[model samples]
Target chain A: MKLSKYNLGVIILILIASQAILAFLLFLGQPYFQLQGNSFFALLLLFFILELAALLIYEKINTARIKTSFGRFIKQIKLGNYESEESHIIQKYDFVNITDIQIELSELVGRIQADYNEQKRYIENVSHELMTPIAIIRGKLELLIQSEKITKSDFKLISQIMTKLDRLTRVNQSLVLLSKIDYNHYQDKATISFNDILDETLNLFEDQIRIDELVIRKDIKEDLRFNMNENLAYILIKNMIKNAVIHNIEKGYLRIKKLEDANGIQIINSGAVIHASTDQLFKRFQVEGGYQDSIGLGLSIISKICEVSGIKLTYTHHEGVHTVTIQF
Target chain B: MKILIVEDDLEILRTVLKYFDSFGYVLEKAKNYQDGLAKVNEFVYDCVILDLNLPDGDGIDLLAKIKQKNKSTGVIILSANSSIETKVAGLEIGADDYLTKPFHLSELNARVKSVVRRNKYEGDNAVRFNEIIIDTASQEVTVHSKKIKLTKKEYELLLYLVINKNRVLTKQSISEHIWGDFIDRTDSYDFIYSHLKNLRKKIMEKDGLDYIQTIYGIGYKFAEREIE
Candidate 1:
């Protein structure tokens, strides 16, 4: 039940003005009744009741309204765009502006995105800049350790230190890559092979399957070609599979199949039931405590791809099964 | 190689200097951009690592000075400010790499190695650390004498790491490099762990030493050699 600052302010002003006007009229018009001292008190009571009723009516209209983030601004600009709340966060915010409200909402969302991107970029650069010197230090220290002929235990400790350094480098690598994806400046086109893409996606998940003792039912057709970037396809499939794997009953049934429907080539993964709002199902970091290793960018990246490429991606839960479908 | 490190914070400088001590390179330090300018005028450095926020002045101005004095000398600017405008300006004014603060020192070292390698070594296709070999021309990765099998992603991942080997390659960079605009938010990084594990296993099975080191709460790195 979030209301815009403007709407809240207007409601408060209306309530206050109504009360003040009603109080003034009751004070001025009380003598017209001329009921004398005791009756005058009764007249004042009636005026208070009337004021209260009026205030209640005003509160009802203002309090009943629970506007979305772009609600007020959307109305102010009047893009004449209407969308169901069950559909998308994007539904309300997607516009190039024509109305003032639309322009304001658009700018606000852009500012948010820019802020996140800037933070992401900052961390990435910092981590990357820190890497090489850490590496050189680790390298030089390792060289010195060998030459100095340090104790076996001390050498082992040095190895541990190096391991920590390695982790930083890896984290930095992921950060920089994530930041770049967030910016979305890279739009280089490539001939993507979906068949090979499935193979690679499987390659990514093979170890997880082995560790979990889970079975993957593969029903993919061979030599499927698409004029899209293969890397992104792999990301989409991988995230779908990840969702299935992470949000499943222990040793659950995981199905990976590609079939053509009216939408396009659909990659469907079936797992346990997903209980959450359907609208934000594809949003980044939707799953809570399902997996900590994920940096909450998988589904986000997938949704971004679907947005940029005009592909249809949907998630559904029914009959105790969660299905993520991507139509390409 | 002679290089100037322009930074304000003593902790960062101390840590960086302590880390680079083993590199055995001719290193000059400056606490502010004014001192940095003085050093640039006094000595001829092959490269300079400039930090943006200095105690006295912004490193950006010093960057232009260094570039004007000697275009051949490579200048990699460091900044706490990572605004797009700053990045564009830094690069436009002839600064090579712009790195933000609170970063892993290992990644810094890698960037330094690359800048130096590119500036010093002309078209060197081979990068040799120890037993492993990354040949740019042949596009072949070999450890000692055995041929290790690698997936397309794994190969690209390794090549990216090795090229930026000494530096910290953030997980985000790794995912983007491998997947690009096709990232799915549902995808977990655990998959990356598996690949890294496999890559390490393959290298170890061939009797080669493990160059890959994990930096806790960060990312992986190819640990630098220490010369005591």
Candidate 2:
């Protein structure tokens, strides 16, 4: 029931052609018509030009409307506002063909949104379910060891096994945190000092930092505040610093510089230049060479946190110094 | 000390009961919300280890019931969910401390002792073991009335060991307790050994009795030396 502008243009062209042929036939029957036929032909040519001009104007308005509406829809999708996809795109116009495409796209988006949510829930539920048993197993093992039920030789083996379980627990916690960040699960937000977060995060690595004899140069301004989920903020900064220390050489230097604009923080650490492709650095389970202690989820979690928190993160390596800059 | 454990998981319940048996704690157990609530109403306890998940009801409601009945009993929430919201809710509802699941038993033991000590003394901050004394208020440790300075980590390590005295504490448990979740389990705990050495040296320098015993590649223990 809908005709496109191109179809209308074609129909108008055919009508003009038929009228022209009829006019020519009529003119052939009258000799006086041939005497002023040049002017008459000129008038007909002007009419054709006017019709084409009108068609172009109509097409221009039509395209502008479509472009604005579709542009808004795509913007909403990018901004993670999927709930408004149906209502914003449902306005009826002289765009029946476009309406068909919109309906199909809406359905496709709905399916994908549903699928993504299901997977997110699955990750959350599975991680949650895994924790209790892991905890119980750890408890039982500790109890067994405490009770001296095992021999001294077996104690060493049990301790090793416990370490592996600890790794599993860490991985579970990290995955749960990732899904939480991905789903925007932490809702409470407050203006907190990034300086405080960094200081607190660094405190966790005090032993390692001391043992490694790493030199720290800090240029953070006092009380640099940003609004974010407190827990996510802590994890983000901690992972960044941890990555720096874990990947650094003996007696390496760590430099933390806050941007003059007060909108970003940069961390530089002296280490062997990262040999992995830039693409692989932030990937999960992509541990660097000889860094067996790392499960490689740290940077991936940091990336997800940055995404959800609307912070920009960039990594660059120069002169054996690896730098990560986070723009708030 | 009299302690009550309200947990539904059979394995955890059995293990906790068995572990606490060695500590000589007068213990009670409940498996559901109703049972736990009824027990909380009926008996006075030094501390209650409450798990957040209970069949037939929520553990939060049970926590409320326990608080309504006895405001003095210390409650430690043991939960699998480590969300901040849950922790805040539990603490706001009068829980003393929170421990996420898959924790070391030694850590749990330490937390329980801390809670019980805090409740029993009601701001009485001194912990005494023969010739040594730890003032929780001052964060100070003394040997035979002579002051000994300890690092923050050394203090925590000493407190954790003393609280779980006579029990063989593994290096894994010790590291987990002292460093918390920040510890990389795959790495060697030579750092813990260093801290232990410092604590032993500081205690020994003050002419205090050295109670810390290494269990031959197992872990360290804080107990009275058996007169051999």
Candidate 3:
């Protein structure tokens, strides 16, 4: 709700008209003050102008009141009245808080732009991700159906199609989760132990690591904790370790060493040196070494966590080891 | 294991469920987030097939929720978002795998089978495809019972194609999968072509029918074409 009496010209014009009209009315209404009948009509006209000026000022006040309710309009939109018809604004007052309206409209436009950008990205990814298995299934099934003989060998392709379809299913879940993160879901910030969250998260993967014939070494400082949304933290650690395990050389070691200070924790992994630039590791659809299963979101989720919280995160490759440092 | 799918689109859900049912998989479903979460918290599943988009909540939130409840349950994130961000979410949430939408049901089965085999059938040694064999234990590949030697890149390419064969996989996908995500700095995909050519030659030399098909404006399809 904003009202500013900043237009001196309009105010001055009204003031002069009021003063002129009052003088003319005094001259016309008093017999002692009025000498000529010709000027009587002129005086009457001046009185009318003063009366009109008062009404105009009252109208201005009412219009300002109407515009002040714009906040309610915005709130309604947020509450899902996005499809509501635009309220028709009557009384064309030029230079009324047009800038404010523009700013709000611009923000609406920006959000729409963001939505489009996000949708475009998702479509490309879904198309790419979904298309792979579909193409495989369609192509293989097409081949198998046309063949005179279903080679005992061709049964494998059907199974292979099954495998990709399964991957497609998994990718879809990951995609849905990504959108959730984008919308800032799980944003209830709280104090969390860096080590505790890491350990708990690591436990989820411990059995898999053991089965894969890999060792898990931990050098995290006990009691090293900080304030953050625990859910995001869990996501950060789980993805980092998963990336380390999947990208590592066969029988290669998976290690978690956290360096804690007032700054933050650094989760370090010893695996095949990420040959790609450290930045790409965080990009969507960015995989390495033709690893089909890696939909390439390992570092991106960590980046999102940094964004939601005031945490600073950076990735570096030094001496064939990938280091993701998370600073509070 | 019976999987309960949470998807908004009935068509895709039906299609996917039908495909899984073909493979003798038992399935359950919910159309949105609340229903999906309820099912997840209530049931013990060997593996979960989760989607990224839901009407009530973000799929990622569900991911954290699911992981919090059962740390060991396998999760395979299924989404229309093949974004790097989403993939990382599943991985970070300790999900077993990630797949994207409009996908063939078969790819989903492969990842499901893999998760099951790894989680349930750990001692089973072979990940087999036709005459080609991948000893997941030793990371070895065999074509038609004759071992075809491959460079590291070639091996990965073969495995990727084999896993998603007959699919129209784009070159951009190939580059990302094989070369890591730092693909922006590179100049040409001629290397991918060269590798594909070499891989085809290796297979042909071993008397295997050439299966990699190039989709004109798009990418490659790893399926054997008619020889006529």
Candidate 4:
């Protein structure tokens, strides 16, 4: 029986008020009942007993009332279920102080939501505004390279600059994509088959697969469907396949299998053992030594998407195989 | 080929104009929304290169207007907006192709030609340059009518060079064109060398004509060179 500050205060007030009234009654009745000493004592005792009963009743009733009403409210808040429509009024059992706290808490939540929206808008705006200038610079560089006056050494240097600029652009674009996904821009979802998406994504890597002479083995179950943004799904599967292929050794084996419980998909590839810890691998810009060509945001983006979607993602390395599993 | 470039940035507009002019493409220019819309309404172009963000109005609206005016004209949206929604919307309406900004000009050149070919020369799918013939649909290449086996990257490299036969594509641009923005900056793009070498070898095996020429220190060039 946890008592709120308001309920506790109310009980204290009841005790103080009851004691004052009893003292006053005794003062007023003292002269008239002075002659009957025993009766006067009984009267004082009865008044004190009644006052004590009143305090006890108030404490019991209010404590239970507040516990039932505000306990659920706090639980809902803990669960992140912000209910703005709820008036915070427990019918027929409202405490003034509890009402005040509820209003303040509601206002706090509203402010948090507003701040979140503003930050999202700012990030998206920065991303969109950054693209134009990056494009202009890239275009200008290309034009400069195309000019006949530039010497061979100058052209080589300019090409290096172009490469760096391209990397910057990619990082910016990925940042934009991450924020967009975080903000639920791709909200329109439909039932999609992962098997089909995986097949198509594999087709995209057919060239790289052939070039590396990789052996691919698959045991994906047909018709494994999930509700998600199809484009994101394709990106997810593509990134995984790309990671497997990019890191795998030449003539390595790439294996993909659906979990027996139909809860997830697993990919295992024969590659050099990853030196970075598992947690570091998901971190942004944490690329291993040999995989220098990686943008390093691939796994980070995958991790972010999984986080927002309530999916379980895990990574492990054993012997020479790197394994990634995603449980939907 | 006649091309109309609708771009607000003066540098890009002028650069594209000069480059396209060298390609023998009669070009038209519009800097903002009103001028671009007016030009779209007045004349037909073999291809219209449009930017999504314009000064006066939205590029998507102009794209819709162009499609309404002339369905036959090829539309390629060149925009800095990388959102998938915008790409889908542009294509859903009537745009023939879409190219995100910071793109290799050579890649744009190839895409524009492919769009033009698809729209204008619907039946003729093969791109020919002297002895080399490229069938776009079948992804086949033949030198002197001799079928040659080339890897996917090699095929794309050959097709890219053939499309922009005389133009000089920088090594950086060639890497971007083939790898599609996946190549890292720290790593040297010398990997493109191996792909280019195999392609050259295959073509040379078919015939003694070495079409691919190294432009000293800059990059490789595919042109009709004097056989030494």
Candidate number with greatest TM-score: 2
lDDT of 2 by residue, A1-328 (tens): 2456666777588658866885676577557555476866776677667767776676667777777777766675676643333433334223435657877776666676677667866886787689878978887776666664677788778877876887898888888888777766776788868898888778888888888899988898666778988888888898899989888888999999888775889999998865787669888888865787788898899899888888999988876789899998
Residues B161-187, model 3: lDDT tens digits: 776665555554565566543232122
- Candidate number 3, chain A TM-score: 0.58
Where does model 2 exceed 4 Å of error? A1-78, A81-117, A147-150, A260-262, B121-124, B185-188
- Which sequence of candidate numbers ranks them by TM-score, best first? 2, 4, 1, 3
- lDDT per model, in order? 0.62, 0.81, 0.64, 0.78
The stretch of ten residues in a row with the least summed lDDT in candidate 1 chain B is: B180-189
TM-score attained by model 4: 0.76
- Candidate 4's displacement at residue A103, Å, is 5.1
Writing each residue's lDDT as its tens digit, candidate 2 over B1-228 gives 889999999888888888778788999999988888888888999899999988789999888888888887999999988788899999998999999887778888889988877777456677788888999878999899999999999999998888888888878788878777876744437788889899999999989888998875668889999999
TM-score of chain A of each: 0.48, 0.68, 0.58, 0.71
State the lDDT of candidate 3 residue by residue for A144-190, as single tens digits.
Answer: 43234645455455545544554554455566556666655455678
TM-score of model 2's chain A: 0.68
**What local lDDT score does residue A299 receive in model 4, on the 0 to 100 scale?**
93
* CA shift of A251, model 1, Å: 11
Write model 4 residue lDDT over A188-295, tens digit each, in one string: 788878888788778767657777789998897566777778778877887889889888888998999998885789999999876778898888888884776677
Q: Each model's TM-score?
A: 0.47, 0.80, 0.43, 0.76
Error of 4 at B102 (Å): 1.6
Top candidate, metric lDDT:
2
Kindly indicate the candidate among 3 and 4 with the higher lDDT.
Answer: 4
Who is ahead in lDDT, 2 or 3?
2
